[model samples]
Target: MQFLPVVQRIVADRWPWPRSFPRSLSMVRSLVLGVMSLFGSVAVAADWPGFRGTGDSVATGQYPTKWTATEGIAWTVNLPGYGQSAPVIWGGTVYVTAVDGAQREKGFVLALDAKTGKEQWRHALEPTQKAKWSETVSRAAPTPCADADGVYCFFEGGNLLALTHAGKVRWERSLVRDYGEFQGGHGVGSSPAQTADTLFILIDDRGPSYLLAVEKQTGKTRWKTDREARGGWSSPVVATRNGKPEIIASSAGTIIGYAADSGKPLWKLDNVVGNTIPSASVSGDRILFGGGTSRSKDAPPMGAKGNGCLRLIDADGKPGYESVWSAKLGISNYATPLAYQQVAYFVNQVGIVTAHDLQSGQELFAERIDGPCWASMIGAGDYVYFFGKDGTTSVLKAGKEFEQIASNPLWAAKSKPKSAGNESRPGAGSEYGAGETVYGVAAADGAFFVRTGTRLFRIGQ
Candidate 1:
């Protein structure tokens, strides 16, 4: 029955979602625009493949807005335990995930070498339900989904594997051994939503929530649904409308859509409020979604008309979706609200970066960067990266006015890098004891990986 306070980072901005799910921008103009840049250009390797990359976290090349902590980095790697998950690439390899015991009962996946981060294979996993490691629980927090047929990962104790880009496993599932025990204490941060053979997965916990799909070549299940216990941690996107594919799902009070091929439902929009931790973003046919500040002041309005935009309307012919614009201020708390190109960024949680106008939500420019962003802001070519949790990243200018351009930093408070100790629990780690923060961000070939819960860096140029 706990509807808030899951990880409670001091409170303030409470919502900001954008699990985008916008697929083909023609694969970002055929593998990232004028191809790579930051110092020597011509590297060309694009493939971020999941949790926001390509689904509209936007990436079209030209990374590195000025580095620090060792000059534009290029390779860092250290992880073996802590993970807030997010580091997936495909085509030169680079998958990630972690969670060591203290009761997390181990889980890993690794597989680096995207041009020399090395490692190459790890696998591990085995947590049918151990749950005890903390920092408010959710260690390996969901963010895997590669393609060219492989990498799936999902841990939060329920496990869900799938390896194979040479790491070899190809199938594994546990969801607490076939669905049960996930009653919320903030475990599962939901992340897995493919299409090219299904894979969805949502699970809003409190007990009994659901939204599966599976079958990406034998993991088998294909359809589930259930939902309505609602605790919220958002993640499940994949849009398309009018030509088929669906599955959006903005948590908490509701924003459903399902039917990515038989999971059915279709459309819904109910009450909604402070949107359970950011997760809904797409651009072209719009979609966007936002929410924050709701510890229940009777809970209903989340400001600026509850931050909005949704459009997938066919009406008389059935298939629907329509809110069509609302942000005159924008709201979001755990990062995840960026539309790019047509502009629409919101940052809230103490860094206030609003910029709306992705087709008429007006309010262009709120300003205040240098922090706040639990990883969810990356729009390549012509910049738009915010990354800061405690490592600074800023660089904005996707245009509509709020130009920041560069803030960079990533390590240098005495070199940062400490949270990796668990050796049978002696002192464990994390709770912010040195992991420094910066939870996740990714970019392809030309580099910019940045994930910290014990390091992952890459940056570039």
Candidate 2:
């Protein structure tokens, strides 16, 4: 389809028509042009449109299982600046975001040719709010989501904008300017979630925390629901419950569902202790919530929180949800709880993966992989890929049993790029200095786009 315009132009101007061209043939040409215009670049099934893509559930189509630093690599491209956001794919273009300078003064949105990893266009995003950049703080961590209309990006510095496929800015909004300055120690990591017409953003900070729904086309606030001041970085998930869609947020010890259209509170599940970082995952009528032990000393044990499936029930003329099954063995710390193939998988911060039966919540096996994973595990077909924080990925067979497949490292060694050295350093043995960490990833069109802090890699057959 790269030459689609050329084909259209030729048909319009240079069609080999005789002086007495048949009117029937002219009608045929007009119909062909109309069909092309009708299909004009909508998001197909192959597009990974948003965060954890459709609740981080199992992905269709086979992705690459094994790859080395030098082999099976389609192309590796250096980004303009360091970014923690995952690379999102929409057709032939891959969109990613990054922040530049010591104070994160400038942000970058880049569109790359998906096949060759060539730079298609780069748009420098000027931040509305300024903050001193540091390794401990988030740097473009909120993964941008894509749709057929455009790619929408949100930065921790309070800038959100929509860009077309050809690098045209549709609209931009400053959340801090519209709302207020964020007062969280660490910056925002919650990515944007969207339905057909609205985009949902979770802003959970110590100062002003709220759930906002924006009109996708105009970047205007549709509805805003303010909440108690709580510091959390969990992203919101849009799920259909009781035949209508609801925006679900499991953070700061509560799992609350809000009506997507009206921003009215639907139902709330309390006592989800230490549930801050990982977003909720959806599986049919069941929603899987995960939490780890918080750094606060008084926080309850991780198991005390919502670490299981909840069945949305509509009984006695009331709509509510109840926990169907709870995890007893391990709880998710950074990664969201994964439920695939009737098996539930939980990964702790130290890279230990625990499997449980999706129905009974019985622990199947507990095994360690090459982890300390920050990026969530993506299940493709019969294999689940665990992206480690420090450039290694462990692939495992997806089933009730723990079966190791392959350990793929994105880089042979931890090499610091010039861009990474500019950031201020934290204390020794801190997680801050790991420049090669895999922040997030996206899989689509038979390729896996792995996002490290400073680069993006495409892995394919």
Q: Which candidate leads the pack in TM-score?
A: 2
Runs of candidate 2 with Cα error greater than 4 angstroms are: 1-45, 299-303, 415-434
**Across residues 1-461, which tens digit of lDDT does each residue of candidate 1 receive?**
01112345423510122235438777545323212211011222477877776466777657778877656676676778778878978787778888887988888888887666778778786788787866677788788888777788888788787877998887787877787878777687878877766678888877989898988778878778898897778787776654456778888877888777788887888776667777888665578877776676574644323568887777888888888777757787777788877778888778889987777788888989997777788888788888887777889878888778689776654433344432211112122224467777889866788777766767774
Candidate 1 local lDDT, residue 409: 79
Candidate 2 weakest ten by summed lDDT: 1-10
Q: lDDT of all predictions, in order shown? A: 0.72, 0.75
- TM-score result, candidate 1: 0.34
lDDT of candidate 1 at residue 138, scale 0 to 100: 77
Best candidate, lDDT: 2
Candidate 2, number of clashes: 0
Error of 1 at 89 (Å): 25
